[model samples]
Target: MLKPRMIEEKMLILLRQGKISKWFSGIGQEAISVGVTKAMQEDEYILPMHRNLGVFTSRNIPLYRLFSQWQGKASGFTKGRDRSFHFGTQEYKIVGMISHLGPQLGVADGIALAHKLKNEKKLSAVFTGEGGTSEGDFHEALNIAAVWDLPVLFCIENNGYGLSTPTIEQYRCKDLADRGPGYGIESHIIDGNNIIEVFEKISELAQSIRNEPRPILIEFKTFRMRGHEEASGTKYVPEELMEEWGDKDPIINFENYLLQEGILNEEKIKGFRKSIKKEIDENLHKAFSENIIESDTSQEIADVYETYDHQEIISKSNKENIRFVDAISQALKQSLERHYDLVFMGQDIADYGGVFKITEGFMGEFGKDRVRNTPICESAVVGTAMGLSIKGMKAMVEMQFSDFVSSGFNPIVNYLAKVKYRWDQKADVVIRMPCGGGVGAGPFHSQTNEAWFTKVPGLKVIYPAFPYDAKGLLNTAFNDPNPVLFFEHKALYRSVRQDVPVDYYTLPFGKSSRIKEGEQISIITYGAGVHWALDTLEEMNFAGADLLDLRSLQPLDLEGICASVNKTGKAIILTEDSLAGSFASEIAALISEHCFESLDAPVLRVGSLETPIPFAQTLEREYLPKERFKNKLQELIEY
Candidate 1:
């Protein structure tokens, strides 16, 4: 507690000196953060908010690194990308929270779920401000934690005000803990200024959770004496209220309690304060002296893809005919059987086998512990998978349908896609999205939405058309150290079957497979379009057209597309998404930029109609008809 206070005091001087930019002081409420953290086991995870510097110090984060991170030095936790307390270390089992506070609570549920699945007697604790309780993720996280009986502790630091908004303006409840019972979790309120009371209550609650594996919400009724940040003046806080809270300062009260109990004398107190000051000074100097390095590599590549050691996949003895849907099940089964760290999470996945029956029989094969069902909360499902990934565990999350991903869009694009580049952390998560049209599922369920994810950096987008590619690419995605968006075409699930390799095999991303070779026109596409392009070519019996299938969108196979275009001197790009700013447009632009001189005619692009997919089969086919794309291909060949 003294360490954080002392560091904050010294760092505030740095901020004034222009050596640091932002600083959050946990001045008046250090006891709650320190108390809850000090009581936790070392292996247990504690994701601290920016104000919870006491928790960071309690977890033994080095003062030099913390100061360096504050200074935005190259040697800092995030290599200077993150500011203030927005950093975490896997070695210390600390996950950092972003400026947006409530999402980490859902992620903490994931960490706790991992512990439960592994049968580890450990818990995950997450800190948030009173204002954070109003966010939807806070409610979603708590509800899932209750439903799953996860060992998680949500410590709400109710400091009476959220920056400038008072508690009365924030929520109607007298206490934030009162809302926990509504979610079926026990709630408690305690005098956060008293260190002993805070520690004892948290220790008892943590122990009970470890035994029974359930969530508990604890609201530490404390106060933040300082403004939200150093620059944010506390002019809005009435002086009377400030003085009242100042007298109840946690450090001063704890110090007095220790002295009156004869636990510490004046000499020891002076020595402790002096020692911390000296340490802070030395570390502060080290932080400012370090250099800062910045790079635009992620922007240049549009993303960062992980390269791993080549592990030989075990293959089955004989090949067998398998549907694309069955191949996905087999791939998941293979991954779980091979890697103990791998876990599967989705809605109705464990017992009901998901809406598509893709994960059918997984519960019986792997048990309820590994093949688990999640609530309808998409953000929690995706966010928790990130938590599991941070712990060096492989997690495969099913989105149920691609369209529903709009709910979890923030964590998916913001955190999961940026984790590897932002902090050099490998977020090895695969989100299996059932996508594409022609299923008569309408706009809510039958949308092909790969374009939205392809634009996000630090994310790998893989869409396979065949059962062979589905099984192989999925296994490959599992081994990559980057987050992968694995898109499965709903139409192709049962429509296509080939002699699949009944063994462990993996396929590389950014590699295009040639469906056929031709001389006049080259056609490129993916997902459902790949099969459609093949059928159209067979129907036309045109030996003058070439077909290429791009398996991944992020690390796009530009070389293959350019080579085919150069050979044929004409090209056509196909996709299931609408033509306006579609992935096909990006491909067409690439061809025009690279193979412009080789082209004999203008590059043509074809895609679905610019509108939501309709439920009627006739409208759906017209939306992304095979004849429409074939007509464009024939026009390109004629040109």
Candidate 2:
């Protein structure tokens, strides 16, 4: 406790000196971090918040490396890509917290779920502030953890203020732990300032959790002695309250007790402080001398996604015609059979098979452990997948509809998308999105939101039009060590059919398939737009057209797109998403930039009207780009 307190004090000095970028001081609340971390086993993972510097120190992370991390040096855990405790280190068995405080709780639940699935006697501990308890992720994580009886220590460091807001405004309950009973979880409240009390209680609870494998919520009642961050001063805090909490300082109280008990003397304390100061100074000096990270676009791009050796997939002589939905089910079954660590999770996916019946008999075939049903908690479920990925297990999450992705957006865009680039952690999770319109599902259920994910880095967006591509690309997505959003069009689930290979086959991403070839114009599209373009060309008997289906959007087939565009000299990009800020616009920009000299006419784009999809069939037709695409193609050919 004293060691981390001293380290934090030194960091503050460095922060004021402009040596380090920022610091979240855990000065008065050291006992909670120190005590909880010390109680956990070396192998048990702990997901820590920014203020929990003692957790890292207690876990024995090298002082030099941590100093380097704060200094944004090349030797840092995140290679200087992230700052403060915004990065995680797998080597130390510590998953660092993202800026969003509540999400890590769900991540902790995932790690615990992995342990339970492996039948291991391990548990995961996660920290959050009292204010973070208000987030929906908090309730979702607690509820899911209780439902699954996962081995997790849900630690809430109830520091009096959340930024500037006091506990009075944060919650209605007297204590944060009181809410645990509502989730059917065992709850406790402890004196976070007392190191001995915090240590003994946490140790007991952790052991019980490992033995019983259930979630427990423990609130460490403490106060933050410093501001939220170094820059945010404590002027908002009342002087009396600060003085009262300052008098109850954990380190001073512990020191006083040690002195009275003859465990430490003034001279011994001074010597200890002197030794710690020297250690911190030496490590800081070393960190200061370390080279700053230099920008390398090539290396930065390479690090965004993990590389995989593409292998040619051999197909069996026998093939069977199947619906797009069946192809997806077959792919998942094959993947589950191949990878023991792979787990499938979604709402009503177990016995119910799923809303689209994608996993019809998955539970009976793979058992409940592999094929699991989750509550309607998108944030927690997505976060759990991330945690499982961190544990070296692959997870498949089915968002019932792509529209609901907004609920799970934080974990997907913030954590899973940036995990590999931040700390070289592979987020081996695939989100199955049943998207698109033409059905009467309306705007809430049917949305072509692939462009939203495609714009984000560190995410693979796969939108397949055919059953073969759906199955083949899914296999590729499962094999890739990154997060993939596999968009399955709900409208084409039953309408589309193809003689897919009976044997397991993989397709490489960033490769486009030429459905038909011509020289006059190129019709480039993906997802439902591919079908519309094919029909339009066939209807017009347009022999002078090139039809291309881009299977993957992130690792996009730029070479294939440029080849067709350069050959045809005229192209039309079509998509189901709206025109403004559409992926079609991005494709047009790329074509114009790469094929300017080859172009005989300006590249045209066809997309849905900038309006929410309606329920009526006629209105939906008008809203989509099907008819517009045909007209646009003819206009391009004429031009």
Candidate maximizing lDDT: 2
> lDDT of all the models against the reference?
0.86, 0.92
Give candidate 1's whole-model lDDT: 0.86
Report the alpha-carbon TM-score of model 2 versus the true structure: 0.99
Q: Alpha carbon lDDT of residue 157, candidate 1?
A: 90
Off by over 4 Å in 2: none
The residue-by-residue lDDT of candidate 1 on 55-97, one tens digit each, is 8888887888887787777777877677887777887888888
True-vs-predicted CA distance for residue 574, candidate 2, Å: 0.8
The most accurate candidate by TM-score is 2
Could you give candidate 2's per-residue lDDT for residues 1-639 as a string of tens digits? 878888987888888888888889888999999999989999999999998999999998889999989888887898889998988888889999888887898999899999999999999999999999999999999999999999999999999888889899999998899999999999999999999999999999899988999999999989998898879989999999999999989999999999999999999999998999898889888888888779999999889887767775867748999999999998999999989999999999999999999899889999999999999999999999999998989999999999999999999999889888999998999999999999988989989999889988999999999999999999988998899999999989999999999889999988999999999998899999999988888899889988999988988999999999999899899999998999999999999999999999998999998999998999998999999888888888788
TM-score of each: 0.96, 0.99
Worst 10 residues of 2 by lDDT: 308-317
Q: Write out the backbone clash pairs for model 2.
A: none
Per-candidate Cα RMSD to the true structure, in Å, reads: 2.1, 1.0
